[model samples]
Target: MKRISNLLIAFVAIEHILFLIMEMFLWQTPFVIQRFNMTEQIAKDSALLAMNQGLYNGFLAAGLIWSLLIRSYVEQAFKIKLFFLSCVVIAGIFGALTVKISILVIQALPALIGLVVVYLSKPQENYDVVI
Candidate 1:
């Protein structure tokens, strides 16, 4: 379960990194414009805002990655994962409410699944020695 949770968390983190690249580096490109369903004019108009939003996504990705890297303490890791995943879920909900329903599916669903897996997983058992 922890493996699954970690994999899901990593997946979401990579996803956000990709989003950051597209929004920040490719915001005005035709492919990005098509992906976001924006007209050229609108994409140009909102390029700066998209870059800022992309930076926030980068932070989200960094937090999740940081959670994964802190392996020295099990309890601390669990807390970090929970906190960052919760943040993602909340942001996804807010984006869905204000921008698009797809945000709920694309952003929130994976984090929610990771949250549930982490919640139900037995963290201590992983370190138990069977003697």
Candidate 2:
């Protein structure tokens, strides 16, 4: 269960890293334009904002990766993973509400699953503390 949880967390982190690349560096590319259904002018005009959003995604990815690196302290790792996964789920929901419904499936669903798995995989002794 721990291994599965970690894999899911890594998957979410990698997804965010890909998002960061797409939003920050490839926002104006033809593929991105087609994928986003945006006109060239719109893509050009919104590139900076997309870059900022991408940076935030990168931060989320970084936090999840940081949590993975804290191997010595299981409780600390659980807390960090929980926080970042929650953030991803919330961000995905917000994006879905404000931008597109697809965001819910694309961004939120995996993180939500990961969050649940991580919670379930927590050390038994740590169950006494609220997450």
Candidate 3:
């Protein structure tokens, strides 16, 4: 379980980095346009917009990184994870709704792992005894 949790965190970190690249660089490129089924003109016209969108994704990645650091805040960490996971879920839904290349598997895979980690890892409380 510990190993799986570590792997899950690592996987999400890498996935977010990839998203940073996709949004920051490839979003307006021919590759992205074709993959997302957007017009080449639109891609060319909205390079900055894509990068801006990528910044929000980067923020979520930053939050995940923070969560990994402070294990004491177990509930808070899970809440952060859920927030980002919800974003991914909504994005997947939008992609599906619009018939775009949603990449639902990739979006959901890390979230599923994180959710499992949270579900399986029990919190340890330190009780104070007055002397």
User: What overall lDDT goes with each candidate model?
Assistant: 0.88, 0.95, 0.67
Q: Considering every candidate listed, which one attains the maximal lDDT?
A: 2
Q: Which candidate is the best by TM-score?
A: 2
Candidate 3 displacement at residue 4 in angstroms: 1.3
lDDT of 1 by residue, 1-131 (tens): 77898899999999899989988999999898888789999999999999999999999999999999999877778888888889999999999999889999999999898888877774764443121
Model 2 clash number: 0
lDDT of 2 at 77: 90
9-117 per-residue lDDT for model 2 (tens digits): 9999999999999999999999999998999999999999999999999999999999999999888899999999999999999999999899999999999999999
RMSD of 1: 5.1
TM-score of model number 2: 0.96
RMSD each, Å: 5.1, 1.1, 5.6
Q: 76-108 in candidate 3: lDDT tens per residue?
A: 765665566556556655645655454566766
lDDT of 3: 0.67
Q: Worst ten-residue run, lDDT, model 2?
A: 122-131
Q: Which runs in model 2 stand beyond 4 Å of their true positions? A: 127-131
Off by over 4 Å in 1: 125-131
